[model samples]
Target: MAFRLARNRALIAPAKSALGAIPRTALFYSTSSKPASSGQPQASEAETHFGFQTVKESLKAGKVAEVFSSVASSYDVMNDAMSFGIHRLWKDHFVRSLNPGRKSGGSPMAILDVAGGTGDIAFRMLDHADKINGDRETTVICADINADMLKEGEKRAQQQGYISTNRISFRVENAETLDSIPDNSVDLYTISFGIRNVTRIPMALKAAHRVLKPGGVFACLEFSKVSPAPLDAIYQQYSFSIIPLMGQLIAGDRDSYQYLVESIKKFPTQQEFAVMIKEAGFMNVGKGYEELTFGVASIWKGVKPLDSK
Candidate 1:
């Protein structure tokens, strides 16, 4: 009986020894196979359009900043030369369309104009709200990614007497995140000829939706595809040929203007952009876009739902 018991003990000893030989971590954790790679480029290293050229998505913002900085001082002059002063009329119409300001016995609107660093749209919005709506309490926050552009806006604001009125302010803000802006704080969001320069249009639209109050409006004025092939051809010729030359002559920055024209061409069409706005969780009216000047430009608006969280 003793010999048999000793034999059993010997067998148990080997089993215990084997168990003790195993690593503690191995005993507690199992090895896992590596996840299968999607075989696509990483998002940070993704490619995005910079005018006619494709560039790293991470670098597009820097490139756009350079372009805007180069043209900051002469931006309005170049706009006048390129559009033959018709841009002024377009802007007037755009501001009038929104009809910004205070309602009777209602709170004044809080406006955010993204990428409007030159103060053109900001001034128009404030003017419309002040002069037309008689809303002295309304205020505008003009944001742009470029500091030089914002300086130009501040200069214009000072010149226009808006600085003293305290109705308009400027900030250096990227359209994609707008980190300085609080969520659900804005009553009206406007981006005029600016969204295309954004590295990610969808992200900008989402940010816009995030910042706007429930029932707040999102309005965009942008260059778009022209109707009628003959007219389009004429417009295309002028855009490609004369615009860059005008940029060189007026702004002394040919590359920047060339890039601007290319960026405009790269922008999504009116219908496509409207779909993007709707995808950002905004409610649209009709097709959600209005073509201006034979579709040379377009106006798009969307409203955040009152029931939205």
Candidate 2:
């Protein structure tokens, strides 16, 4: 079946079809509730992972929505407690690395920050463009599926004096579809610590490719596999032991935080995800990713091919 799909790949856009065309049975590991081996899963019975738990693919979005909504107000606080404020450094580095906005010979940027509901990445992008490059026209649309999260972000933007400046806007959007974003309109597409919660990552990648203008860049920063056997061991212990405790103490939502940690474990390794980026028709540099904080998180980037229409 995999071979057949590979042979027919020319007939379909690889990013759009990769996850949808493959049977869920072929894609994920099953628990004891595995379907019988002889037949395809009923459409309604198709399954995917929600953190470490198996769930109907259709329900994953709602579950994720609940998690984010529950954490919206305390999101920033939990981030500080859980990672000891290191996530801020990672984010700052991520934005500086991109150096968004008008470049040496480029025009002001139109950046779409998917799942950046709390405006962390969006605010940084605007600051980088305005403060670093003197590119005041660079604007960002911060999109997320959860309204409560967007509300928190909007409130923060208002307080930060961005709402009046028209440099950043928030929208309710699904990462997989981006229904309101126009085709070929974005100069850059970014998602930070957000893609793992998506129900269908390949579909999100396809949407990103669709919205980005040819030559536009796609950048993602997400929790990722740590390295060196010893460091991984220590990191795993800290994640499973300390994060949920911090969540309970700070946000009173231990389960959501636990799920978040598990989702990180379930995400693809850096190399595996880089291949997905390439398969989505984006051009990548060799290896295609860089690890930060000893691989606690990583950044991956790709560029839409100039020849793409």
Candidate 3:
């Protein structure tokens, strides 16, 4: 069945009718049972965890790079298969919550979707804005560290008729240092399911802060801590025992999926991450995040103070 971007910004899979969409997963392999820290290597240690295995912090980026490069082509298909298209719903809500696409003062709105290698979020933002304004003045910069992923994103953009329209662009950029993006230029900075993989979460958050204009918003959607003892227990069983199996069946890449699961475990909890956002100089830190899907994933938001610039 083919999937199309629905008017609600959800990815609706081809079905007999509009009402047949239902999400469906299981995996096993994470070694840690508790929620994680920001996952940056401490100053005293030069090593970091790579899916329950320790590796030199300097080498983690390359390893993560290899994983994405291997899966870039199959990324979209696997995402649908694994999540049963539920991720599309999460993404839709993420963009809608921001709704930062309306034209302000007859100028094109700037959105920097960090680590948006495949352009899903960027495309949604463009569609959201244009549907409202009926203009092509909304542009998105889809940035990632992996060229292979960016290439795939560009191909998809072309498929969606985004080529030569100036509605979308791709860039190879590091999250911790957006050297090419000038300070206070971007209106919205978004990172979905990407921040946990960074070598330094604080540095990345700082960089996000630097690039956004005062009053610009920072948004992230990533796996988060789940609650209620019974549900957490079931989720652990499914993620650890079934997700790796799904990875092997869908992409023939079990290890990469295992790493992804482990990274989720190692990511900071919602409250902890909210604090980090505040530390990076964002305001409304207390009300910055919303839990989605009962915390299997979450949306975190913070804004630069309008008085800062």
Candidate 4:
């Protein structure tokens, strides 16, 4: 009986040794076939569009930042060349739509222009309010995520005499989360030709809703689909071929231009995007969006409800 018990102990020792040899981490992940990778566990990287490429969601923002940084100096020039200055007319209409400060309670209306690179929309808002309403009190905060783009905007603002009056200010702020902006403080929120580039469109929409005061307005002007077959064919060709060529010639950055062109195609249609705005708790439901220039671009507006929770 002693000899038999000793023999069983010898066998158990080898089994215990083998169990000790297994990695501690392996024991935790024993149910899975593969081990958990080293370093920060890969983030649950849900994919988002970066033009035509299906990139890891984590990498899209960096790529977009690179594109904007590279093209910041040349962006305005390319816009003029690609659209033949027709973009100006669109922007003029956009500013006119808001009639900003014209009807706001006789106080300095606070305008938050998100992703407003180079202050194009903000400048328009300030200029119109100054000229039309003689509203020296109105102020604009031109917010952009890209520093290089914002720097360029500040330089332009200096040249245009907007800096001295203090009517316009610049902040480097992300669209997905306007971290520094307080709740229900902004009087008007405008994003023009910029919404499609956002990594999370819904988050940006929510941010817009969050920042606006009760009865404040939210407006977005963005590229849209051309529904007519013949027009779409022409538009597609121009965007895919001509726009990239212009980028190469003007900005010396063909890849960035190509990405921007492709991004325009991936954006939602006017009506679909309007529904998204409503989902973010904006009022006017289905009645706030308008298509322009044969659906090449669109304007969407929503007012925060006065009695919102």
Candidate 5:
């Protein structure tokens, strides 16, 4: 099935001119959730941009929730198609960087995997945490804004039976704000492929910084700009064209897939994103790229200082 998808992707390359316009269908998809009233404090208008031509700031959570709702059942398949199976490797790298128990002397590690749809990162983290801590417990709260995604993740986790109901928990929460979790509690906070969909990324960074314990780590994995002229061009073609068609063929949801492509283009580059992390009060911010200069994705690491004021 994967081989067939790859061949089909190769045959349907997009033209350079086609990339200039965002699809109207994607930008105007009807959302089931309404934005909170404007009376509530809102992120500054100047800080916003279209996730896919939809006004992005106040409505970002609802719009993003809609996108995931439309594609939740097929989300994993779309991920494999879009990344050509490289997302697994990228996630593995993110986990290995944590070195889960090397310096902690087998103490239990608590992780907050924000926007961890379908438990992909959470499951892996649990496995590695066990290896590192032996009998010590590992707690992961997989939080996401979309309930459908969270339900799906919960179902998958139950099926694996690797996580007892107590060890891994799911919460419906926004990435931009996590009001329920206590400050200075989480040892590591990680969000994979979900930060770009956030309404206020800076606020999300601040929330992450606030949640982590002193000396805790924050890591993110998301789509990034590709490098070197030729591969970059090819990647652009593949993302904007073949990916949406795959969605239509496999998931029956082309518009959501198109939004996925547009959102990636709208995301900050690695350096700019690192700067955002620094602005959130994290220290020693660093970024690592994968898949050669293609820059298909990146893992960013930052530390919340033990002495942060």
Candidate 6:
């Protein structure tokens, strides 16, 4: 099945040239076998499109890792410049909604912040947990496929005094196959600004469901479809044109940032994503939208059923 998908992708490539040149990395998956490893696990067969190119279901993480590694040193600066610091607020809102309770109550909140480059979400979550729980232990694991990003995250965490003797840890792992995380362990699972890069979003969603405990909360912060037509038009213009230019100027990588914007537009809408969440064995899935001018970002929440055993 996976081989057929790869062949089909090759056949359709000429038709989708409108989408842009096929990434060289896309050709890495042309054969049924895995690509030469960067020491990561083998990829699965359930592949999805990364822009116009069809990559292996499993190789997407390695590609995403390369992108982050190239950009990691300048990632935070680029993020602030590109979003005008709005990304922080989006993350803040996501943490507040998690409602880390007082620690004296019981077991510390266990959170897996997937694709959480540079430990942004994990840092904020730990801060919230400490404030609310009063020295209660909150475990936040910052997981990403990019070693460079994980290293940067660790550096930032250390510089900011966010890492304690035992509060936060970093791992290089892929979201689509979170086999490293034990089932029914985490109280909350989060992926911010990262899912759009995933080639198999549904598989990632299913993995989230698998790792989370029953009653665990799943939250995501991602770029979403905008509202109000006038603002939408302006937002699209900025995303497609301005954002990549900013990336080039700030990060010295125009094409990567261009790919980033295209990937966001290719992502599912807030409504469609909610349905995917439900289909992944989550319940009561809901989404909250934040509109900045015509551009929109969203936080999606869902609960893993206690009865899902």
TM-score of each: 0.85, 0.85, 0.83, 0.85, 0.82, 0.81
Q: Please rank every candidate by lDDT, starting with the best.
A: 2, 1, 4, 3, 5, 6
Q: lDDT of model 2 at residue 139? A: 76
Q: Higher lDDT: candidate 2 or 5?
A: 2
Error of 6 at 8 (Å): 44
Instruction: Estimate, for each residue in 191-232, the C-alpha lDDT of model 3 and write its tens digit.
Output: 999999887789899999998877777889888987767777
RMSD of each: 24.8, 11.7, 11.0, 23.4, 11.6, 13.4
lDDT measured at residue 105 in model 4 versus the true structure, 0 to 100? 39
The model with the greatest lDDT is 2
Query: By summed lDDT, which 10 consecutive residues of candidate 6 come out lowest?
Result: 8-17
Q: 111-226 in candidate 1: lDDT tens per residue? A: 88898888899889888878887987677788888888888988887788877776777777778888767787788899999999998899999999998878788989899998
In candidate 1, which residue ranges exceed 4 Å CA deviation?
A: 1-44
Each candidate structure's count of clashing pairs: 0, 0, 12, 0, 0, 3
**3 or 6, greater by lDDT:** 3
- What tens digits encode model 4's per-residue C-alpha lDDT throughout 139-181? 7778777777888888888899877777777777778888767
Model 1 C-alpha lDDT versus the unseen true structure: 0.77
Worst 10 residues of 2 by lDDT: 1-10
Badly placed stretches (over 4 Å) of model 5 are 1-47, 54-56, 101-106, 132-136, 162-165, 285-293
Candidate 6: tens digits of C-alpha lDDT, residues 1-309: 000100101000000001011111100111122222535445555555655567665566566667778889999998898777777866776677666534443555677888888888888887887786574465677877677778888888879775655667777676777656777777778899988987678878999998787777788888888766766777789888898898889899987788788888888887788889888988744343333223467777788877987
Greater lDDT among 5 and 6 belongs to 5
- Ordered list by TM-score, greatest first: 2, 1, 4, 3, 5, 6
**What overall lDDT, based on C-alpha atoms, would model 3 receive against the true structure?**
0.74
Model 1: pairs clashing at backbone N, Cα or C within 3 Å: none
Judged by lDDT against the true structure, how good is candidate 5?
0.70
Q: What is the C-alpha lDDT profile of model 2 across 72-181, one tens digit per residue? A: 99999889877777888888878877787776665677788988878899999998888898987777888888878888888888888887677777777788888767
Selected candidate, larger TM-score, 4 vs 5: 4
